[model samples]
Target chain A: MATYTRKNAWNQNGTFSNSDLLWYAKGVRAMQARALNDQASWWFFAAIHNEYLSGQTTFPGWAYISAPPAVPTSPLPSQSIRDKFWNQCQHQSWYFEPWHRGYLIAIEAQIRAIVIGLGGPNDWSLPYWNYFGPGNQYKIPPAFTQLTLPDGSPNPLFVKARYGPRNNGDIYIPLPPVSQDCQRNTIYTGSNAVTPNPGYGGPSTGFSNAGSVSGNLENNPHNMVHTYIGGSITSTDYGLMSDPGTAALDPIFYLHHCNIDRMWASWNAAGNANPTSTNWLKGPAATGGRKFVMPMPSSRAGWVYTPNDMKSLSQLNYVYDNLSTGITKQLVGSLAQRLTKLGVNLIQTQPQPDENMDMGGNSEMVGANEGALTLKNSGARTAVRFQKEAWAKVPKSLMNASVTKVPDHVYLQLENVKGKMDSNVLAVSVNHKLAGHVSLFGLRKASSNDGHHGGAGLTFILDITNLVDELHLNNALDADSLDVTISPDNDIPNDEEITVGRVSLHRQPQS
Target chain B: MTAAERSRRSVSLLIFVLSATCWGLLLVKPAAVKHCFVTGGELSRTSLEILLLTNPISPMLAGWGLMVLAMMLPKLIIPIQYTCERSFKNRRFRAASLFVLGYMGVWMVVGALMIGGILGLTLFMPGSYTPAIVVGIIAAIWQFSPVKQQCLNRGHNHKALAAFGRAADYDSVLFGFEHAVWCVGSNWVLMLFPVLLPGGNNFVMLAVTLLMLSEHMEAPRTPRWRINLSSKLIRILFAQTSIRLARS
Candidate 1:
């Protein structure tokens, strides 16, 4: 008996019908009615997000797993169990996709069981809110915004703490342009924790326990959505969705994550690879070899899963309604062209000798060693202008090639960053036009006491190829020298020292 | 052996000889000095006065220099090796020597300052354990500070050394100086503990050396409430042990 659950788009009118919404509301109501301490209760599910297990246990139904006697002396019997199982959300790592997939499955199973108990449909699957979907669908689903269901019962899905426009009125908050661009990232993974490869997933982080830098997908859209929803439009008060501890309490969080998970599926379908590293697949667990363990209802004996188990939806006995076929082909096809264009640009940029040059004549040799610049005490906006000689030395053939033919993907590489962790995002631009930005969300410098530099401060690579073309800098008529400006998204203190030991330009080869 | 291997062996040998010489001096030092260090015994007023009058610069510097060689040289092995690997094969010795000179120069200045401070304090404030005890407690507290961690982190930071010529020489010396500054910043308080103590006990010096090395070996600890608690507990335990020893 394959448990095939249909996950429809939240805002898809015909796909997620009125009856399905009613059943979901009823299931949520039933789950909420259960004692907070019960494993089946809504509170028990949310407690998993509140990492401080000992503190959360005060809200009934939250029980700790008893430690086996074989285990060494328990520090504080209760704390030991909480430490072992609680606080296990994998963020800022490659395992972000697979781990969350398993988590969603576990949560959905509990919801389905409740739905069935309430005399709802047997196949009551979770509805995904595809915020990145085609027009009008980006808005918050009406079912979630309504205070009451069709029967005049209080809607369990309604969360008052959400962003103003979505909660107060019908105005849907449009996704920021930064988030829209993240969807165009063709790469699935990066080499290290901070390689800024514009990958859908993050670099290889062992066990997904701790990471200094976040993957492009995790940093943008995923993180941005949380902050935007949680942050007030008028004031600085962060809503429940703002912090990871309280983010899950908002009903919309599940739907948002489901969409993200769907993106991963779509990314894979469009021809991208999940990390095959042993560290990622089994995870870097010392004792159990390599397995990701999640605490669930005792009867189910908790879900101990691996990345291998999450590769396909069939293994989990469920599939997204639009994951395989729909808009993915178009999205993937366009993305492939962009990636190919980048590859062509790399080839075009390579310095080649001119055929007109005399073979026997002494010609000035262009020095390969373009001098490196170190920027210290960089503020909110720091600009570096390339020396005229440096730009002049570039071979005429490399500069004369039509920018359209090349499919440009130029990158500004900021290497060996050392400083106190500043939360401000650095948005890179060429001349004055917008290029791309790197968020310093998780990559804060560890306080001196911890001695952890989070792998020696992250190396950010911001793609500025499009900016060059848009500014007409590739043309001979335009300025020969390039001006790269690093502008922080927020006002950063002028005194804060952010030492970029080396700054260089790189052309990423198309895979 | 290959030139590189031979150079590495020579560096190791130099460190070993210096350390052994320091240990030999400690073992064979005058009983008066030994008594002052081990038992926390104070010098008689007449002996102190005579010591202040006599030129003690040569002996004091030699002793301090040897102590630094024995205690700190082992810790420099990694940095020295890193420099050697980056340097041209033939110039490895020269690079290593210049690095050592730069590093030791910082310590020599610190050593001279300590001698001057100690001599002045002894001359003015005769027979006072108040300053020593206060300095010890402060040093202990400073161990867990963020500044200390920053210094340790800075000490761990190493840039790629240049392969040859003036660039190589400059990089080697600069790296040594940078490393020395951070190392001293991180460990100065701990180093000051034995110096400030009533007597220059070899045991106390060895204990401080071990503590410094242990902290260096451990991963940089972020300042967390739990870590602070544990550090406090360790301090309490150490105090308890000291009391027990005094009673015995």
Candidate 2:
């Protein structure tokens, strides 16, 4: 098989054209016309990612399959395919990157076949929406926004329900929320053991849907994109892009995920390693075991895969057109601007170690709030009292930047965040300095602890080393308690809908 | 500490007290504790009046409820912690109390039915371990079954609770009941096995309790026929030991 290069959707390097998107739109339209029960239908492929509310008769703005035929539904998919492949999207797990890679390949193969049938080029690959690319790329591609094709036919890529931030059917994704800070993470896998480490991908687990905590990459740009493009948090019916179950139903979702896959490739190119563990390579196993399975577009059995099978894009017969324009470049530029505003001497300062280090050792919970705080439309605040005894347990050089190369990292953890809906993004700050934003994009699924992380709910650990450094510089580090504020970026009608079980702080010393 | 933390601590204390008291009673008065174990042979052999005079319903129910509090309350920390955390700080205790009441209420009803079933089985086949062994085998088979795994998976489910008034109370109780329903569905056979044994004493109960706790700790997987011996407790213990050793 010949390798194909997946280019940027916005025609960043001027290599891509309108015809690529036109052919993609045509393929999508052809797939949409198939029966809901058909294995190769657009609904079938989307359902494979997730179909949370499958029993519901209506899906608001989009077509829904109320009751997909039972196993042995279609001969093409077969009973085995229906049993294992549907609703198998790996979210909140280490397998997330690999699982989605296989999903995109399977869907792309189906679409490519359909495109070929419609007399399109054989080498056509899925174009990625690189919102972090260059000038004016943050906005939704014009092709997706267009109501009709050049031939004056209805555009399959265009959906009328997109209720992005403006709530005016425009998707202008803000650059700040979708930071590529995840590229700085050195470790491939993180542990939620006694000492929690937020890995670049996610924590190690055996087949997780909503694991304890999201890997830094999944938490940010990936989730941020999902929320903003979906709609405003306050909207009655957020678009198909809001929730994972309906996200793939939207045409832009594939391109969004294609860019996310490119991030993984870019991360690897920077010399970061993927996990070499047997558990990760072989997939989650116990008695019956679990494997990544997807229905092939042709007359063949379902394609069974492991993380090992998806470890290489070259092996999969595809490569990204460009890997140089990942989020790290934007992050560095933004950091320099922030530091300049703070009057830091850029020439004299030494290059600091990666702040987002996944230190695997004994991390202590140094402070916590007295009770859970229900985040509101206006905002919520709490005082996390530092345990006096905990300070003595760690190295005295904790958060002391001048004395150590690998100083202890102070992390703010929002534990067990439960919510009824998605598309809410909360700006979290420590002592009034903006630390990070918690994107509750898949709050519903992540909160449903039934099948995943044992009701741990969604835990977010934001690195606040720099914030702590500032606090130390001002002699504010010795205070008995730190004021933590959670303010929603968008208005949330129901205060009862979202609640953080606890606001705690931990200090992880470098190993 | 936070109200949620306080609530969890209190729950731990309650479990410890209940377990200690029950275990002490079992040690001091094994015969009296054994009387609480309902059996068909005694009911068929003795008159109703004699049975009432010897084995009273009040003590039996009390012993059974005490047993449940000791053996099962530990398994409910997640939902109880969640209930407390979700409620107003002042109402945390009330919310958790309601949840415990609702959980124990379901287990009480199920315990009565299980007692009745044990009586029937013992009546049909008296003075033999055959029935007990058969029930044990059935429980073992059910452990590997897909339906049982499905029930275990459902047991981890929790939902957003209302923060105020009767809605909060109702939601807490409803969550408790739902959790109990799934819990009983997954462990009914394992629970039934101990009751069927001739000397179904506290020792057997303790062993079964450990098994159930271990099973609950395992992450949910695809529902299929498979043996699940993954002990998260053991893993935690090992990890903690390593961390401590490395630190020292």
Candidate 3:
């Protein structure tokens, strides 16, 4: 059978066409109508989430269920199914990408089977939101936002528990765009499970949970999207999407995860290699090594899977409709190689001279700002503004050279960060205008011995190359400075001090 | 060995020798104190007066200092090595010494305050277990408090050191003092547990030292209301043992 293709929700123009939307709504309604005990029912799909939240069980009966079993006497018992499922979901591990890939495939198969039974297209596949793609399509799809279908039946895709802005009739908040640069991280994994890597996946960790650190992609687009969609009104309560335990309950969860899985597939196609270590491919399940076991009620048995089994989308009978990950891979590879060489030379030959100025002189407490650069803080914003003079110390010639270089990425480095990880998503604005933001979801506090910790704190590097041009600061001849403002999406407690030891601007060389 | 490596070895040797001597003295000391006035212990007015009138560096104070050296100095290896690495080649020993001095200075002040507080308590009140029980409960409560976690987190913060001269000297000492204050804030209650325990058990002191060391080794955890004391401690112990075995 030909592999199914998962298309972007905004495959046509900038939004889901009326027909695609209709089919999706109908499929969801059909799945919801099935008996709660039915493996293909919406409730059955949701139970997988509940199992994960409850954590691993120790009961003998639950721990030893057979895999890919024959038809069950009753839809696998919701409460009684012994160790049948939810044993694996990779969080802060090298195998995060593959585990989630297998997970998405399992759900898609069940959903597709139901859709076909309801007379939908035989080759139907899950649709991705593609929130990082261009234009207003990043906003919640109209189909999901609508209270009822065109024929006036209640839309199953509409979830009431979503962020208020998303659920409230007309007023909608567009999903924030994640940096493409983060997706370009070349390393597959780091030295240890807890150390942060440039890879698309996180550091090594135990089953269904994150280690001390989170991967860049998982941290930003993956986590930030959840918080943004979940909303941030009450400081005490994280929105449904924000917390992993309840994230899947939201209808948008599957679609969002589908997009992440697609990105992983793209990352692989670009030229990076999945870990081939025995520990990664088939390590012991008890120690959170290799081998992911997920329960499949539709099949009436559990399935024990490995990264090797899920490495190829074709093996799972699926492909993305419009992915050009190869092109991105090549571009990023060349740029990264050039930067690595340049970095070595810079470190060896040139040490920055002391400017005799106190580095801490520029420190300021976060405050609300208005005017052309409107700093909105409705229980969801925390911002700090850096004056233009902060950049005066840098040589004008060097600054110009950094921007003119095509592939060279400029970054605002936040060093020695000390604050609660639960604070609002961090956004960077150039000269009062919004540039881009990074999600704090899954960020680990730097341990004392971590090389990156440097006794100060963890360092966060945000790419601001595109922001410079977008703000029309690219062509100024004289020493041009920017009022770079760093802000969070939610209010931090006044008593809690979130200090950035240093904020310096630097550029990475490109090929 | 390279000059840098040799310097590192010499510094480590010096630290190890000094620490071993203190620990040796501590291990050989009598388990029970006859004349010594234990902090928060049942006390008599005459014993309190004797403690107050004696020299600050009396045999009791010496024992306390030795205990601090043995239990706490092991935890300072990473920071000490870090300071040594950042100092000038000729002055590495000097920087390390100053850093140790600053760290010990903070602990000494804490020791003085503790002694003074005990003297005051003994002088004002009759011998009773009320203060000890209250302190024990407070220590248990603090184990699960957000303030304790914050102090522990702050203790892990490492700042960059200057490479040479007076600047390096000043920064090294300052960093040590800062780290010592946070460490004490994080672990003072645990340290006081044995002191307040009736008849001061040496095993409890040893257990508390192990706990302090293990907690410092792990990363900061999110503050939660639940305190699974035994399970967490067991996990840390197992992890430490496994690490040692792997290294061996």
- TM-scores, all candidates, are 0.57, 0.73, 0.55
lDDT of 2 by residue, A180-269 (tens): 777666566652111135677876653222245677788888988888887753444666677887788788999999989998888887
Write the residue-wise lDDT of candidate 1 on A160-241 in tens digits: 5555323333425445533644444445563211123535677555211123446777877676566545433222222445
Calculate each model's fnat, 2 decimals. 0.11, 0.13, 0.06
Residue A352: error of model 2 in Å?
Answer: 12
> Which segments of model 2 are wrong by more than 4 Å?
A12-17, A57-82, A191-196, A207-210, A233-235, A286-289, A326-358, A391-395, A399-405, A449-456, A494-496, B1-125, B128-154, B157-185, B197-248
lDDT of each: 0.54, 0.69, 0.54
Q: After superposition, how far is residue A311 of candidate 2 from its true place, in Å?
A: 1.3
Give the better candidate number (2 or 3) by lDDT: 2
* Error of model 3, residue A250, in angstroms: 2.9
lDDT of 3 by residue, A1-511 (tens): 5478888776664233645556766766766667656655654555554322222242101122221111122345554452244324445456667777777777777767766787878778888877667676667676676777777777777764455333333323344354444455554553111112334565444222213334666766776776677654444333445545445545677888888888877876766556664445553342323245554545656577877788767677888886653324333234223324333223333333221111111111111121112223432222332223323322232343321232333455554454433334767665666666655542222422221232344455555545543433444413334466767666665533355544445433322
Candidate 2 is graded, for docking, as: incorrect
Listed in order, the DockQ scores are 0.08, 0.13, 0.08
Question: How close to the true structure is residue A497 of candidate 3, measured as C-alpha lDDT?
Answer: 39
lDDT, candidate 3, B49-128, per-residue tens: 46565523465556666777877876786677656544434565787788888888898788767655655655654355
RMSD of each: 12.7, 8.4, 11.7
lDDT for residue A301 in candidate 1, whole number 0-100: 41
Q: Give model 3's share of reference contacts.
A: 0.06
Model 2 lDDT tens row, B68-102? 76667667766676665455455768988898888
lDDT score, candidate 2, position A107: 85
